[model samples]
Target: MMRLWSIKRVLLAALMLALVQSAGAAKPAAAETLTIGLIPELNVFKQMERFRPLGAYLSRETGVEIRFTILSRYGNLVESFQRDGMDGAFFGSFTGALAIEQLGVVPLARPVNLDGESTYHGVIYARKDSGIRDFADMRDKKFAFVEKATTAGYVYPLAYLRENGVESLDNHFAEYFFAGSHDATIYAVLDGKADLGASKNSVFDWVRAADPRVDAEIEVLALSGNVPSNGLCVRPDLDPGIRERLKQVLLRLHESAEGRKVLERFNALRFIETSVADYAPVYAWAERAGIDLKHYDYENR
Candidate 1:
């Protein structure tokens, strides 16, 4: 009887152990997908082509699928990050500030361009012969800006205009159109569709090389003070381990020949570590301009 009782108890204990092990295993692990959201700041297809290789490299390095999602506008990208749909993103300064304040997304790194600087300028541009000699000359002239969400494309230019006593587009220009991106704004000016345009100075420099018509058509009238460049960021809920790993990988990209080639496609010289604190200037600018640096609740939309 004792021997039979021992066998029964041992079997029962074994079953209990199995049940405990299964319960522990059933708990979900950290997220498997790392979704990267980007603004369609250029031709959508070209943006995808520029980033696909980097995404693949990241996936191969981390053993996690890196998915790239392009939102129609920067605002929508901010909304998605707030809702936790995106694990990370590459965002302009304005949108990145919104994500940091509203979604708790943290800035991880920024790309350094060939100039060895991580800051870009906001430039006011016009045709050399348009008689718009300076920003003040923009009065009664047609203008183009990227979407309102863009920093150099809209915010900085607007702020600069307002500070110089130009309050509204109506008060300062004969007409204004949103070209939707730095490239498009430049294009609009080159095509003679607008008398003045605003764009990222670095973008202007790079694009001018590809299409010298930009130089032949438009001249920079003014430039905003240096502004921090765009950056890679991650949602607040991201696993710290994964985030750290990503940061390490990014920082070393320019160290390898293959990595440098990938970054070169974006006109990036290298990746440098960054943090939410580094973008405080951008937040200050938005705040002074009375722009809400928070993502609108879009559950219904």
Candidate 2:
């Protein structure tokens, strides 16, 4: 009886040890990092610096590690999303629409401006002394556009030019180039590198505020019809719970002091929930402009 009892005690101890080992092996590991991509609307350094606080806020809110990435070109942002390289993105209206149609990205939220408006216009501008008074005067002048994928910077201006009988940029302009960013486009024109340039109105306004001389030096030649605001989007396949939480955090950003600071730094009044249909105007513009949705290549430019 004593021998049998000793064997039973040893077996019980071994069983408990096995259960402990199993629990240790099953313990959860740290959360995986999520990467969010941004279009090159501004200088890369400024983009990262301005967005880092927002990324950190998201990380803390979702209990998931977050990293921000800025693509060198707008098309690269779309390519990255197609490749599943980005978990989420802050996409311009044109690129956002393309991503939605191509990759099924989910529109999450968009920023509201201080005027309580969620829409912005595209503008063509030139040096005040350039003598280019209107869109018709832009013909045969050196031109600079931000990027082909940019709605305010490229598409709107291109459509306006086409409609006004300035059909071919390559044929009409003495020289032209993609300045790669809104600031670059403005500086190109101000420095006399280009006679005319195009960019989003809000961005131009921000630049004017930063350097009052820009207002004195530059004049708006024409403005495009209203365009949808940029939007935050996520991969359709992103974890549903995480996606919902991220949307909630952005929508509620104005409700917190720290969040408000972040929003202010981004030059936004607040973030509001957005839907896929909000970008329909962009699609319509593209269709009317005869822009090839699937075959357009940003690399060859």
Candidate 3:
């Protein structure tokens, strides 16, 4: 009777081992996925559509499904980042610097534009018919600005204005408000909603190409010095192999026809490696704007 009981136990153990082996055979490895956040540098829908192909491509190449989340505004990045539990984000210059300092994320890659330009500039612009060509002419005119956390949109433009002898935005302009995005800020001035506005040169060019009214009505007033373009950064604690694979995939995108298609949609020629050191220009502009990164530090609610 004891031998019979031992035989039954042995059979049960063997059956369990067979089931585990079959499961392993069915799936050699569990599929993995990553969720990367996208800053609203462009219209949210456009940003997602533009990046979907890249995400699909990366997923196919790396065996990791890639997902993206579009952040509505730039101001809440720090707290929102932790809240969303994203794997990483494609950060704009100012926010990228903040993330590096605060979240300890590592810079991975940035896109070089099809125009052979990797850096972008802050552009202050207005309607050509507005008769405001220079800084002094901007006095008492309604102003449109992108989020305060932006470099080309707010920081550099404010610094440029203050450096040019403007004491106060409220005192100088009829009124000013954050447009929530670079393209929206540009449109505010072009559509006569605001007299003057600031945006990144890249988005301005994009807007110009899509609308002839842009050139016929609007004119660029001032441009900030070159600042590093938006770059992808990831949590420092991310798996090293996945991190390296992502970087390599981005760097090599230009090598294939399908990859070229993705780059063309992005108006970029290729992706280049980046580092935390690339954010130095942001600090310079922030100082000129009299803004401190610490002041912008966000907390979890």
On TM-score, the leading prediction is 2
lDDT of each: 0.82, 0.86, 0.87
Off by over 4 Å in 1: 1-31, 295-301
Q: In model 1, where is the ten-residue run with the lowest total lDDT?
A: 292-301
TM-score for all models, in order of appearance: 0.85, 0.89, 0.88
Task: Report the C-alpha lDDT of model 1 over 1-301, residue by residue, as the tens digit.
Answer: 9999999999999999999999989998854888899986786897899899888878877777899998877678877775757789998887887777787788899889778899887888898878888765778989898877777888788788877887677866888988767888898988889998999888888789899788787888788777678889998878898999888888999889989888988778889988877887787667656577663332211
lDDT of 2 by residue, 170-285 (tens): 88889999999898899898888998999998888878889877888988878877766888899999999999998899899999999999998888899988899898888877
Candidate 3 per-residue lDDT over residues 161-219, each given as its tens digit: 88989878878888888888888988888789998999999999999999898989998
Determine which window of 10 residues in candidate 2 has minimal summed lDDT: 292-301
Report the CA-based lDDT of candidate 3 relative to the real structure: 0.87
Better of 1 and 3 by TM-score: 3
RMSD of 3: 5.2
Error of 3 at 11 (Å): 22
Q: Tell me model 2's lDDT, rounded to 2 decimals.
A: 0.86
Q: What's the candidate order when arranged by decreasing TM-score?
A: 2, 3, 1
Candidate with the greatest lDDT versus the true structure: 3
TM-score, cand. 3: 0.88
